[model samples]
Target: RSNKRLVPNIVEPKIRTIEETVPMADRTMEEILQEPTKGYGEAIVILEILAENFEIKTNLLQLVQTNKFHGFERDNPHTHISNFKRMATTLKYRDVPNDAIKLMLFLYSIEGAARIWYEKKPPNSILTWDDLVNKFVNQFFPPSKTTHLKNEISRFTQRFEDTSGEAWEHFKEMLRACPHHGFSELNQIDTFYNGLNEQDQDSLNAAAGGNLLSKTTREALKIIEKNHKFVIQEANRMFLG
Candidate 1:
């Protein structure tokens, strides 16, 4: 130990001395009260649950069985909302407004950014189930998804190995995905007929005993179903008989 008195060359982190800083302007009690004080703010949810006397108690554990939604792009908000509605309705609660039970439980169902979004909602902003659903769908399901789905429906083509039955099923799936695809029933039938490759079209035409497109929409649908059935029966006969 050298007696050279080793001292730390470090500067300590400091509180500002009164003399080193500008004084907060002298504030009267009224002036001080008028000044906005920094506060610990709690985030508020938008949903307004109207309380009734002896409100039915909702089970949070059951609400969570549907799984947490994190506001991901790939996740379907519409499907989640639908599933949530089904799960919520499954729980029995007497003498309570059904929407009240739903509004309360919906908050607990979401997590991550989805919960954050719910928190940021203005108090009393969402009063009904439809309000919550529309906002959620608009936020998570982008317009681009709708556009992609519509395009898929409009440009639907048969896969190389898909049977006519498979292609027809695939076309129906596109319609289900974008139910608002703006195509009329006739237009849908026409699009499906035109989408098939020549080989499949011949199969459809042969099953129909003429040009399938010349038929009425109802007739065309019947033809489609019959064609698929005939194809299946022929395959079964060849393979099984």
Candidate 2:
């Protein structure tokens, strides 16, 4: 049936001048917020890609957090807390967002029931970003929930048929919920790689030519995806024979 179908045209991407090149950093807060279709995990992936493509110089933690690009309201406290944690992952590298900017951006992003707390701030009373974070954390995250998320992270393993991207995304979502403080990058990479379906783990290992712990997670994912495609094609050929 596929052989009888017409082949689709390969539309080439248009070339753009430097002046026409709008980096993700320059994207409007609303635009960034809308880019993610699979919730916070996908948003983190988008930010990581944007940061790499734009040669971003700012501390990643600050860049992600200070952007204030979440698309939900205050009633979604769980989401806001997750966003904070997603951004916090960069802190392990000794980076942080500017406190004032982070605070203002966070306040502006609030909606629904969450707005009242910010709106009713005492005229002369001062509140630090930490205070706001604590309030939200207590209300949404809580100690028990955080522990459960950490356990989930430890137990997460990719199914045999799952793609590397899908497995990594699930791991990231778990990370956002867990308390990843003091976790080493090497350890994180190992944990993520080990969770992959066994076939994908072997594919990544072969593509990286060993010592994959030194490679960035993004690079590893690309290699695994390419290898997975090759495996699928080889399988199809065998089945046809």
Each candidate structure's TM-score, on Cα atoms with residue i matched to residue i, is 0.65, 0.42
Query: What's the lDDT for candidate 2?
Result: 0.49
Model 2 regions lying over 4 Å from their true place: 1-126, 177-182, 210-241
Off by over 4 Å in 1: 1-64, 67-70, 92-95, 229-241
Please report, as a residue range, the 10-residue window in candidate 1 with the lowest summed lDDT.
5-14
Worst 10 residues of 2 by lDDT: 41-50
Tens digits of per-residue lDDT, candidate 1, 1-241, equal 2222111101111112222322336545565455322111112122222223433233544455457788876567876777787777765555445665566467656878887786566533565667787788878876787888888888989988888888998899888766457899899988998999998898778777878887888988998998878778887899997
Which residue pairs clash in candidate 2? 74-111
lDDT of 2 by residue, 115-185 (tens): 54443443223345566677665645567766666667666788676666667666766675455433465
Task: Give the best candidate by TM-score.
Answer: 1
Best of the candidates, lDDT: 1
* TM-score: model 2 vs. ground truth: 0.42
